[model samples]
Target: MATTTESNPPAKDSKGLSSLNEFNLEKSILRRGLATAAEIDACKAHKAKLASKDESKGLLEIMVEARVLTKSQSMRLLKEAGEANRRVEIPGYQVIEKLGKGSMGVVYKARQTSVDRIVAVKILLDALAQNKEFIKRFDREAKIAAKLSHNNVVNAIDAGDVNGLHYFVMEYVEGGTIKDVLDKNEVFEEKMAIRIVMAVAEALAHAHQRGLIHRDIKPENVILTKDGNVKLADLGLARLTADEKWAMSEAGMAIGTPYYISPEQVRGQVDVDIRADIYSLGATLYHMVTGQVPYGGETAQEVMRKHVDKNTPFVPPDHLNTKLSSGLGVVVETMMAKNRENRYRNPDDLILDLKCLLQGESPMIAGQKPDDLATLAEGDVEDTSRGISEAQLIEVAGYVNGKQSVIVALAAILALSVITNVVVLATR
Candidate 1:
């Protein structure tokens, strides 16, 4: 335990020296201490004279000297106030300190009293609480995040309101976020980078299958666990595909960080599907591999304006990193295509291609037309139960038999086409 004098020292004035006063006394000790109201009043009367005599003396010292508070009482009060200021005690949870802050709310590292488990608590800012739209989005985030149980998605535990404050709790991840890693200028191996993206892609596929669109997908939202697992977080901008709610932003207003905004998202279109996240994912990969966004501008407006312009071409990852594989460049280019139709038709297409690339096989991107790419066989596209494992593929293929195997066989055919194409590129 820290000494009272050390923990609650005298506050500095303009000259950086202690000046004994009522306000400082009240805030640091007197308000919660055993000091009587009359004693406090008495101290205020002589505070000015005491302060002038020795500007370096703290309020607590003056109070003790004037008998307004005994030395022991002053010490006790300092300790009490220090503890109170150190932690924010919400019902059932002890908020240790602030973990992170965002436009919507601030996240705190907290401990749940009952279970003694560490968790993250996000408290809505008072200004946003007054806005019905922000409240709606807050509530929607908790609901949607709670419903999702993917390994790569942060788990929402509980949500409640206390004394007009809205807060939601989630499982605390100790390893921090991808943004933290990128901020350090860390470079990732090609396979490791693709693996991390694959984890997020799988999570997106699950959410997309459930009709939820995560409008914002950036490095900051992706948390890395201690065991090298990825956990996508922050669903405040998520929206249900089936819900006909009013657009969060008005006409000509684009939402999401400009660094990873999709072209449709840049247009401020409210009816965007899962493809928007795919574009953002591609942008994230571009940053991860090349250390820069495809488009650059001083302001978000200028960056978004670049996204809206069809004439601006995307710079592939290889242009920035000459050592990167040509196949990886093709995958990034396919995902970041300005025209949504030209992008991966669905999350599965992206996931399939990524899995193929990870396995040292050619990715499934050849002469396939966008229209044909959009129509994936029924159960194959929406199955979020497992990943792109051979066993999982066999299980889905078993749903149909014999000649109908063409549905399952199509995935293999796509991979085979890419293999031939990759060989041609290698020869060149």
Candidate 2:
């Protein structure tokens, strides 16, 4: 274990001689104890070999071999990097269970003593404490997310650094991500898909109004709650345009997941704006409704290139699963248009279109001939009990008509008999 010291001794010779000798000796020891040039070179060679053998070994392994960070440290740094700012505590929040693990850190489900409520506690690795770039990015995530408050967006409660480890606390979303739902159920119906997408779009609009852009928008980042609500999480790569200090200074380094990246991001455009997010949202919606990505590539680089250079694939409802409506196809295609200008300009526009779609309106072209709702085939709708099918409604209507006819016939017969009886009594 490393020893902690309160302060360093003053550099002074008792005999009034120069203190340079002692300073030099200390510096020499520190330099020797640190990673040597030969060791760094060896680590690099090992990394190259590993990369050649297994392409799946993530970049974190290279950082670890260079003595820049340990495996645990790298994991922690990535986890805390994504969380919003909050106080870090040790032994403060009791760990109830581990929520999940990501590339950077492990998330724990804990109970905060102060509030007596459950929160997700993310712990960063101690090795990353010396990495300034990671620290800046980590802190910025919390600061940026804290500025925007929306029901659809996950809220950050607190952040802090404890000992050498950094951590952040966030509201615990009880349900899993949309990805989980999709894995279990391959595709979503038009109405259910529209509802989920609209919630996410509203959340994005709220953040956009605050000059915040969620750079990473994908199914994995969207959570579906048990209460039938959608929550947007993971704002680690989100950018605040209005804040000059928060602007990214790094160039050429891609910051988003390859599959969901926008064309602007793949092209390394520093001025990427809200439209990029619109494209990602479109891709997400496409995947949810059609059960496939807009484009498929064998490698990450190839995937990113497709976003920049290739046209989005045909996504008619019959293309993937025949159950989807053609109108849903049109909405996805419009949102995922290759040209940014052709896509929805803002989240508000997308949300409005989604709402219109849910209300049986033509979202793509206003005043255009509406599709025949009666001809639309029913797919497996999310069994939320609230979804009423046309077949069920028809059955109910038939039952009601039969009952009404029987009641009318019985009343007529009773009235005729009563009239006959009254005439007989008058004649008598």
Candidate 3:
């Protein structure tokens, strides 16, 4: 996930051109520094010979081998060229000002000349356009965002490749993200915080019904309008159930912000579903209610470790802000339970509880205890089965009930044994 922060224009740097292909190598080399005639001729000859033999060797690799261009110099020029190329005018939009810039893309506040509509255009880094896998993921995000139509979600207007630069156009949300608001106002009013998160919860419910999971949910991704309305932004990390077969994230690597990541996400589990989003949303709400995030550490890895470690119990929001009710704290805790089984089973259930709280009624999930959390093994019945047979479900329920009864019976037997031993020793 990209970090959201306001900054001045990016300098002409090589950070954006880390994935340069062979095609741009020559120009990048020339721009870096003047090469002697012998050096240039030698590099060209080497490149030609390599291409003739294999026809697949990258120019940078061949040039570096020929000692014509240093790796650092080649990298520097690629960055400069990429920065200049991306600054060109877009096909339909007239660039106004940069909204924000990240390593992968720059979000520009632009106007569509044909329709004269203001839109936020996010242009991906030129280097990414050369990467086939990155293109597929970018297209996936665009397609998913375009299909979603909700008042509380940012709408994707258009997306396409322009001169090998992938860009997505979205409706311009005039206000800043929830993070921006929190920066100025440390904490929001209790009612206002609930309202904002409630809107986000409803939006998430809609996405969940369509088999979409917004893997990255944080205050940075939640935009707030001038009129106090919320719009969930940044579907770049979203995934579709149908596209799970083609998931791009590598094994052992999680795709989310550390501060708000769910326990399953921290463990890099592949079966992340809507419950992960619930955990993140709960963390976001926790931040909104208090001035601090739920977890904090010196590094991202440490924060993620905290998420996976049940011993590092989350401090309730009420503890941070004395005015917050214990009931509301329980609601957030249930949503952020370490185990998905302890969380709201579905987004609708979460929405119902949030709505209940809005109406001054006790939250439906207020009684969830830490002991209620249950962990499922990778190939367990609950993990693999989408739909359970009626008889199977009854059997499972009976097993669970019987297990509880067995636990109670065992405890009673142990206690009796202790008492019997005490009596025998006293008589002796």
Candidate 4:
């Protein structure tokens, strides 16, 4: 569709244009680092030279004539410029280039006018602009992101609407996402994966401390820089732990990617929290070490079904990747346990084990915790009779010794004490 030639000219503006200007193409190209100003000047001169012969030759046409740009490149630039002009108009930021487009919106690499710095701006898609739910979610995401401040988190800058078109700006990260590298067929080293995971864990810790839970923690949402800085991205699916009213409203809708979503999210549980994020980060770690998702299925529902199924066979990372250490594998398994109670209680604990694995030592926390035995049962597959296997029974027995059960026991003992005191007074 972008391969059209000059014969099919775009709607014309009156001639006598400033030499280097082509609507927004020149500015867009320069802002995106696609071409230099000198290169544009040369193309302008070429356009001027050929103007007498063909008055209709445009800036893009001249660039193609001089071999400065391929037809497809010129067309794509024109298309993006047209799109921006048609709908989006953020007041203080200049949209540079369309970075990407997804179901929710189009993200652009933009320059903040006042600060004169690069930022990424996400504009709600025109198709969804009138949807109240989408607009509310978009606004909420911006507000929530602005509350977080951490080195490993993408910083939110500004958010507003101009004539009904909404845009949210954030720090521009200049590297590929984990999913990008995985798509390129490049595999991450075990230690590198551990370091990256640890960085995200730190980010999650910051968010969790503030009572925010990032429901979607997939590889695509984690950006990795060449300098080894890992930024946890996209708080679109994040929710406040105390937002009971909002939680009830979204009670039954699955809210995250199937490949990395937690079991609680898959079930659309209202009480989903930081532990759900822990499960997703674990799934991401599993993909990082093995170069594959934890489970594969033809459909999203099939994949999500496996996440909530206790009977699903747990395949440890070392089983998939021979180079994986047992320590790192144990950490992944614990993080992705079918039961959130069996997973790491929080990112602080997860980070500790991740650090230990980064060293030559085994996980001093997750692998050695009191709930480690219950985590073991979470890693087992049930028998044909669909009942808990003998091994699972032993692991469940170990669970009575867990902290939650002990707290329950204490409450029960207090209740019994109160009852006994009342009986003695009545007897007297």
Candidate 5:
């Protein structure tokens, strides 16, 4: 998935052109850092020699034959080269420079000529243009983005297909993403991290309230403006909560970055809700505050297994960065609970807890309450202890960080009741 972050523009490679084919191929390969000059020259010489022998092999074909470029890689660059020559002829918008590319298409910084405003345009790749499913999903992304109007969300300006080219227009953000900030500053200040997370919490609340779930919420999708405003971008994986057809279409497919993906998402559960977004947000916060991912693995599957496997423990963020407050740690842990039931069910509650933390108070919903503030316990304790009183159960429940604790407490109480009834019946 891609966001509209502008990268250093691709430089003109192979400056002094030999022929159109060689120049275009060299530009494509060199621009992408795919091949060396020796590799390109070898293909060029071979193509020249083949031409002498009446053997008609294109430069790309010669490269494939010589193991210089994979067949798929050469084919893709050839397509990109074809696109490079033809200016994206979207009427009324003047293309400026390439911003970035993703699985979907190439994003370009463009000038909306009529409004004279700078915007980002994503033109779908010609390769996937013929697939109705991709077009529908691409249009769905535009619609989903348009449905949200929060200040912390990248707004959709327009979306349409002209001459079979599907294009999406969005508000151009000048600043970098949270990932960029992490790259520059290893970790964020505690208060700054809270504020940044709070902004995204509010944005997710807006989407969730409208029954939309942003399935992907990694640091790359959390955009930071030059003025320090946080905007959540990349709604390509977002889907309506009520859309079962869409759910089935994506069923059993893990649809998020392995690092920040939720456990249910990693498990490929078809019924993921806003809680999935909350989990990803928690992982993103963990990265921001700790300068490390929640799980480390040589491969993505291993990392995802750590997310899905009950045996793998979820370490609190404070465990990694002892500088973090316990309140923040508890919040991250609860939000990232492998069981969705333990995560914050309502986005508004998450925002509220973050607000409390921002004010130097513990997160009420996800963090342990202060001793003085601990009132009646929420539910009964499950353990059949020898001397613990009912008051102790309630007290323990009040201090529990998440719903799982309360449920465990309740189950212990139920087990004790069943055992007592069985003993009484045996005595009778």
Candidate 6:
């Protein structure tokens, strides 16, 4: 589910430590200040206790009694005390709330004061900031992601380390991930599913054109806006074509989530290119349509072996829902092909076939006309050799943005309804 992005060099402050370093330093100073103030308070308490002939407690006992530090925080501080420290500052953005945590870092939802925009800021955990490999990878990925500009891809706004903490800011998507949607509702209708996959395919096409391969593509990494625009997030695991050695090394070590990895990736082959992404996308599409992963096993190793050795299960459109068409099944099968050569040659081709399905044409048929493909209608299903019509394509484009707005509006209504219901019930 992790999204891969290019690493960028850390931004240098006037004093030279990265913004992440500065943030960490500020955090450390605050912690120390709090500790020192507590100690002084404890000393005063001890003096009072001695004068009153009462027993006095140590600093640790006082901190515990006051609930100054949670068990996790205490453990983290103990670990940090064993490491070296450095400090730096980021201008314009202030971390308002934490979004999520990962092995390498924590993601926060921050407000960018300069533009008055909300952004997702990822900061390397203080513990990992000192790891040379993690720092290099973080910088490299941030830089690369900053350079990319694609509608379907989450845009990177800034990257830097403050004090010794590395952080990067990206566009904040308000809607939940595809995984979240699926968790709430197991599967989607074929038409809706195709629309989502097509958007992701467009994103992959853009990234691949930039010579970057998103080694990880999954439902969790794909976010659906309230209006239904699907934006690909998290490019943390992406590898640049230019960094062959490093990219290959990372790929060889099993880079993707086990359930979504391609056969080539599971085999330890570092030469995987766009085709690997195609396979992963196919698996993702399959899950969206059927609510089941193509391959299943108890462990990472077992799942990886299944990816390399086993064939995808029989997943006809009728298997999950009788309303799905065989054409949609064909598209999923083509994507999930174990052999890379048999898969869609590129995302462009995958998108083309999806458009074909939208037009109600048999994607299996040959000699489709580009013009005919471009002239179909929204929600129209027809069998024609030309694929999706241009008009239909335009309608799809309109739907993307329009649907997103609708989703947002619907969410607002739902929230209001919940609040009203709560108030009424409470009053009664």
RMSD of every candidate to native, in Å, equals: 14.1, 17.6, 16.1, 10.6, 12.3, 18.1
- My TM-score estimates for the predictions, one after another, are 0.68, 0.63, 0.67, 0.74, 0.70, 0.65
Candidate 6, 1-428: lDDT as tens digits: 11111274344333333434334433553545544555545644664565467554333334446565455654454344223122213567766544666777778777888888888888887777878988988887788887679888899988987666689889898888889867877788888888988999999999888888888899999998987688998887888767778755755577788878988888777788888998899888888877888777888998888788644354554466667887887777778777575677788888888899999987842222232223333333343454756775576568555656777899999999999999999999
A best-first ranking of the candidates according to their TM-score comes to 4, 5, 1, 3, 6, 2
lDDT digits (tens) for residues 241-342 of candidate 5: 999988888788999999999988887888999999999999999999999999989999999999998678778889888999999998998899876766
lDDT of each: 0.76, 0.68, 0.76, 0.83, 0.82, 0.72
For model 5 the local lDDT of residue 6 reads: 30
**TM-score-better candidate, 1 vs 4:** 4
Better of 1 and 2 by TM-score: 1
Model 1, span 16-51: residue lDDT tens? 333323344365453345577677667655665666
Candidate 6 wrong stretches, greater than 4 Å: 1-89, 310-318, 364-428
Candidate 4 Cα deviation (angstroms), residue 74: 11
lDDT of 6 at 43: 48
Model 4 TM-score on a 0 to 1 scale = 0.74
- TM-score of candidate 5 relative to the true fold: 0.70
* Cα lDDT tens digits for candidate 3, 290-387: 98999999999999989888679789999999998777788889888886777887778887777887888888765543233243223344532576
C-alpha lDDT (0 to 100) for residue 118 of candidate 4: 91
Best by TM-score: 4
Error of 2 at 59 (Å): 33
Q: Write the per-residue lDDT of candidate 2 for residues 177-210, one digit (tens) a residue.
A: 8788677767877789889989999998998899
lDDT tens string, model 4, 105-222? 8898888889889999998988788999899999999999998999999999999998988889999999989998898777889998988999999999999999999999999999
Best by lDDT: 4
Q: Clashing residue pairs, candidate 5?
A: 382-409, 382-412, 382-413
List where candidate 1 sits over 4 angstroms from the true fold: 1-87, 247-251, 370-428
Off by over 4 Å in 5: 1-85, 368-428
- Clash count for candidate 5 is 3
